[model samples]
Target: MAFKIGVYGSNIVESERALGLARELGQALAAHGCIVITGACSGMPYAVAKTAFEHGAEVWGFTPALNLDEHRRAYPQDDIGIYRRLIYVPPSYHDLFGLTPATAEQDWGARLKYRNVISTVNSDAGIIISGGWGTLNEFTNLIYEGKPIGILIGSGGLADELPVWYPRLRKKTASPVLFEGNPTRLLSLILQRLE
Candidate 1:
């Protein structure tokens, strides 16, 4: 077995720069014989899944949705090409340690948070492509867990915001989330971290 790189980030809102980086890194990850994992949502993560599928590589979607019903309903336009490979993990990927926010005030928060942890755990390493708060949460949890992670930075989104955040959490990070530019380099760094 080679390695598994969970590519984490946002959906539906990404700049051209970030998308390009995601695509390139995705292709590289697949070519390197690594499975790419994602939230199975849109934006950068979807782009990477599409590219990985196009290249005939195995891609696993660690979903936050409760089940297939919610996945289809929420992601109306999910790429059928990659959707088939998804591994649905309900609620929160972070529910294990209880890092989830009290959003629903009922029982749904655990599902989402639990899914986040599942996504990070399934991955041999991670790539944080630009993203918003959800993306921030994923990045934070993985870093705290000390996983081998990487960042596709310098284009904006979280990439642009990380300089401030990195310094604050650098000490807490069990393992460094390597940062680099372009897809190939980003993937290589991710690969290196896994090795």
Candidate 2:
């Protein structure tokens, strides 16, 4: 089976450099014979998935909705069609699994957490680029699971902040966590560890 690489990042990266880096990373991941995985959201992750798919790499996703309509409502800004396969984890699953509530006003936050867990659990490793709260949540999950993660610095947000904070956390594990600002080098490093 091809190694799966989870790309976790913001759904709203506007800077040209950051966007370009995400695409480059996607292309590199595909070129290296690795399957791409994402939260199935928009922006950076979408860019990565699109490039990776165009390069003939399988792109799997963990969607937040149970069906197409729900998916559209949940993530109207996202390009859901980019994913080759998406494992749907609905809001009710959280309540069924004792993670959240299944009320009319559903616990979307809890659902998102469950989705992130599912995404990281199925992947061999992860790459964190410029991101927000969601990306940080994914990174923390990966770290706790002792999964390898490559953080792309200079992309801003949590990706740049992690290098400064990871050491302060004083967490230790056998899993490899690498930080690099250069997209090419970061891709190479991640692929090396996976192989």
TM-score of every prediction relative to native: 0.85, 0.91
Compared with the true structure, what per-residue lDDT tens digits does model 1 show for residues 1-195? Answer: 868788878876577777777778767877888787888887888898888888867888877676788778768887756754677754444554556455654345555566788788777778887887877888877877788767777656886688677877636556776767777877777666666
Please report how far candidate 2 places residue 137 from its true position, in Å: 1.1
Q: Give the TM-score of candidate 1.
A: 0.85
Off by over 4 Å in 2: 90-92, 99-106
Across residues 1-195, which tens digit of lDDT does each residue of candidate 2 receive?
Answer: 689999999988747888888889888888887889988888788888888888888999888777778878877876666688988886468557765366745666666778899999998899998998999899988988888899998887888888878888877775688999887798888778877
> Which residue pairs does candidate 2 place in steric collision?
none
Candidate 2 lowest-lDDT run of ten: 99-108
- The per-prediction CA RMSD against the true structure, in angstroms, equals 3.3, 1.9
TM-score of 2: 0.91
